[model samples]
Target: MTTNTLDADLALRLAVEDLYADYVHTIDDDRLEEWPGLFTEDGIYRVTTRENHDNGLPLAMVYCDGRGMMADRISALRTANIYEPHVYCHVLSAVRILGASGGVIRARSNFSVLRTMQEGDTSLFAVGRTFDTLVEEGGRLRFRERLAVLDSRRVDTLLVIPV
Candidate 1:
């Protein structure tokens, strides 16, 4: 590749990585309101089991079809949902950029979340692989779609938070 081409590729990779970092930090820091900003205005987010995904089932544990819906979810979590107080620590592997086309970048990453309760007990909450479609909007990378496929079908507690 030409020097300019190589530099562009590296820049794109770094941008995508930065997006991932920002996403996890937003959730981990209890800045849930900001989570919707990580996506495009009409972005889609879904959480489902690997079994469901592999079986081509349309069911999702959590589904938000747009930024508006995502924002509403956060609002409901803050005001309406009742569950034990807890925090999440997300560990993400390197993003594997599958390809880019029509200004969209397709990528995947493996993730594990640790949940800590108010009483200071911690446990593994979930493990998953995220398949994402990203695009640059107003000079920043944002998720056009984020599909989190959990490795297991069972969740130990209420899953109000985004994974």
Candidate 2:
């Protein structure tokens, strides 16, 4: 490949990696309100089980169709939703940039989240893979769509926080 092409690829990879880091940190730090800003105005977010994903089912445990919806969910989580006070530590790996075209990038990454409650008990909260469609907006990569496919169907508690 040409030097310019290689440079572009490297830059793209770095940008995507940064986005992933920012995403996890935002959630893990309990800065839920900032989470939605990482997406485009019309971005979509969904969390579903692997079985449902494999079966092409449309059901999702958490579904937000736009940035507005995402913000609303956060609002509900902050003001309306009732659940145990917990924090998530997200470990992300295997971030692969599948393809890029038309200023959009397709990527996937593996993630595992450990949850710690206010009582200091910690446990594996969720293990999943994220399929993301990202676009550059205002000079930064933003998620156009993010779908988290959990490996297991069981959730022991109310999933108030974004995975």
Q: Across residues 42-150, which tens digit of lDDT does each residue of candidate 2 receive? A: 9999999999999999999999999999999999989998888999999999999999999989999999999999999999999999999999999899999999999
lDDT of 1 by residue, 41-139 (tens): 999999999999999999999999999999999999999999999999999996899999889999999999999999999999999999999999999
lDDT of 1: 0.96
TM-score of each: 0.98, 0.98
RMSD of each: 0.7, 0.7
Q: Alpha carbon lDDT of residue 97, candidate 1?
A: 93
Give the C-alpha miss distance for residue 55 in model 1, angstroms. 0.5
Which stretches in model 2 have alpha-carbon errors above 4 Å? Answer: none
Write out the backbone clash pairs for model 2.
none
